[model samples]
Target: MFSHRVAALRPSPIREILGLVDRPGMVSFAGGLPATDTLPHPRVDLDPTTLQYGPSEGDPALRAVVSENLRGLGIDAPPERVLILSGSQQGIDLVAKLFVDPGTPVAVENPTYLAALQTFRFHGAAFTDLDWTDTPAAPLTYVVPTFANPTGRCATTAERDALARACTDGGVTLFEDDPYRELAYGPCDRTPIAARMRGGSWIYQGSFSKTFAPGLRLGFLAASDDLFPRLVMLKQAVDLHSSSLSQKIVLDAITAGTWPGRLTDLAAFYRRRRDTFDAALHRHFDGHATWSPPDGGLFFWLRLDRPVDTRTLLPEAITRNVAFMPGEEFYAGEPRLGTLRLNFSHADADATERGLRTLADLLTEQ
Candidate 1:
């Protein structure tokens, strides 16, 4: 009834846990779904053109907006080279489509994005260190170096430089999914490693979901000359292009010059939630578990002092009216069962404190 891929496919733990997150009184730190207040309510001037079918490559004006954004991030992204996607997640599916063949060698981070692992595994991509430079190089590598999901860890300048150098030197194409770049709390450099690897085979992906609106479902990838046209063609086969109405609304927001400030406003608003989250971690899990207080982004990745399986803790967490993603779900290869990820932006101060307290107590008992 189903294909081999579908037969073996495992549901994403992050997505699976979301069902439990919404029950009354559940204090969830599971999903990366942004807080409601941070979203933009831009007005779209709905002409027939806005409702009508648009180019498979996306609305040219929106592409230009993405182009300018890439340039600002230190990548020389020409508007012509940009491929507009339904979301950055679609960009992942496209990259996998273009590169992965059954058992084809691909690399990814030790504990990378869960959805990426799911997409690649379905497409039959073999795992390498995937963390740039650590493993033997593969033809394609996917990474979220900027405030990565689940872990909320941003790669440092030296690490980025090394990854860039390694990819360029290794002749590997990088898929840098950087949706969280603009969500930094204070001044932090968020340069794409691909910026340094110009002319090298690479793909840089960005999303409007985090900064603008998720409903727009807008994301993009900057592919090299060889891969750009293929990705666009593939996207055409997938959905015939993203929503024209959504693209126009985002374009209107940029034209009205509210997009830049929206990014700033998001950082400022989420900073309070982040502060609450980091404080709770330090207070409750300092000795029981170790975690770096993220400077920005939605998640705080933690590794328990004991080798307790986080997967086993979810039922109890849900029973306790709190939820989180086990750290093991993020890994494509060997997993650190002691690890788990907590999201900060969606919940309030009291929820963060309560959730952390609940999780800490569970760990303390371990």
Candidate 2:
């Protein structure tokens, strides 16, 4: 017999949509996958020792690299505070394991990242909307402040500060999941909320999945000294440590001095894709749907002009040889039927145009 947690687990709707997109001639705007062509594949030299098990906290060299990167983001984290995981998604799971219990109230943004909802739900976290004025007394709150997934909205500096203050005053721990911080298209001085908070009040999760290659599955969590040990222990229980070879490869890549230039190129490439997709959306469905043009990131969260259940519309979109994620999966509570998220990063400009046009035509028919 399976445990209740296992029983409650449902397959990710987005993952299911991704499978449908594999059909012949299907153009997808569904998955939040990074553009593979933009990823850097620098040569990494490894010794036999690099293949062995590594430190539970992470490889020291990799932690130092992550620490330096954090400093660039205006966060004052030292190598000692960093715990590397398979990916930032594991960071969410570790946090949930350590903190959340059945019926534990956890504050989450409305229509937040679906995987996060799934992670917290497995731990039996009772979700509530994050509100500064009436902040949830939950011990932890999870937020993707920079170019958040699905919506692609970045929280302003003042908003970050307000949330930090609320969390500090409420004794709530903040989990800042920042996978898209480096992907901004234009000038933005948005800093991590953890940078402004007291040392122990926040834990920050950063990933190479967006900026670099997702297949490497490299990510790190920076927490206060008090919280670091517990996380390492949980990580040890999970997999002993993340892949030793992958850590060395990431370290070598960053140390090689190619990372900075690669990041700039990645940002520029994604910006073009964003523009192309934005133009297509406007040309095809200007008045039929409304969406905030993302400043940076992979997605455009669109709200249909009329009430239409996206879940119901998905089959029709697939029938039209275009696929997109329905909005219901992104919500922790009752979902808004009119919203849907479209990702432009993985698809090329021409494919994006074709997909949007086909999608718009299908919606028009409905």
Candidate 3:
């Protein structure tokens, strides 16, 4: 029999959606995956020796690139502070294992990343969604500060200040998941919460998946000196090390000075998709839909003018050759009706346009 922790967690909604959207003619934007087409110069020729089992921590070159990138975020940490993971989701699991014991009260964004929820739940952490009725009296809090998954909302400077101040005052462990930080379509105004953190209690997780390619499974964790070793141990237990081959690929790519240009090009590409989809939603649904224009990232969190039951509508939409994961799965508490997260990244311009029209028609009929 499985452990109680395993029994308590629900299967990830993204995994369930993966199975349902396998049919032809379905345009599914449920997962936070990059469009494979946007991946810059996929294959790299490397010495066969690099493919062998590497160090338990990541390769040195990869660590340097990761450390250099973190410096751009205002985190002044050496390569020792960086621990590479198979992906950022692995970073989430590491955080849960290192810090959370059973019944540890961990505060999360109201609608947080569902996969992160699954990872934390599997580790037996008790999750409480932050209700901003008044400022929260800290405790351990996890938030996606920029281009948040499911909501596609970036925190304002005031919001970031308030959160950092609250956490500092309350003596909370702050974990910031910042995978989409580089995908900003517009100007960025706020400083990172980790940068503003006073006592170095904050932990920041970032990924090259969206900026580079997810297949590489490259991501790193930047944490306070206090939490670093525990996270390293967790990584050691999980897979011994992240892939040395892929890390080298990333190292070469970043060193070549092409990564920044690639990210800039991706920003332009996704911005067009965001604009086109937003315009199409207005043309088709008129005043029947509302959504925040994402300053960056692959998703737009949309709310219908009329209350729509996504639970019922999802299956119906799939039958009509359309598919999207429902919004209910993102919330830790009661599901938000009339809300949906749509991705504008994976599909091409033509496919994205068609998918929106089909989705709008399906939702209207419901």
Instruction: Show the colliding residue pairs in model 2.
Output: none
Compute the lDDT of residue 350 as modeled in candidate 1.
84
Residue range with the least summed lDDT across 10 consecutive positions in model 2: 130-139
Model 2 earns a TM-score of: 0.96
After the best TM-score superposition of candidate 3, give how far the Cα of residue 38 lies from its true spot, in angstroms.
0.5
The C-alpha lDDT values of all candidates are 0.84, 0.86, 0.79
| Candidate with the greatest TM-score versus the true structure | 2
TM-score of 1: 0.95
On residues 91-190, what C-alpha lDDT tens digit does candidate 2 reach at each position? Answer: 9999999899999989998889999999999989999888755555678899887888778888877788888888877778889998888888965546
Q: Rank the candidates by lDDT, best first.
A: 2, 1, 3
Error of model 1, residue 150, in angstroms:
2.5
- Deviation from truth (RMSD, Å), model 1: 1.7
Cα misplacement distance, residue 154 of candidate 2 (Å): 1.2
**Candidate 3, residue 9: how far the Cα is off, in Å:** 3.4
Question: For model 3, how does the per-residue alpha-carbon lDDT over 1-366 read when each residue is reduced to its tens digit?
Answer: 877776666767687777765578778877776877787775778899788888776887778778887877687567888888898988888888876788777888878898888877777677887743334533578899888888888888878877777776777878899998888888765367888877747788888898888888888888888878888887888899999888887888888767678778888888988898777777766666788788998898888887776778887777776667778778877877888888878777777777778888887666
2 versus 3: better lDDT goes to: 2
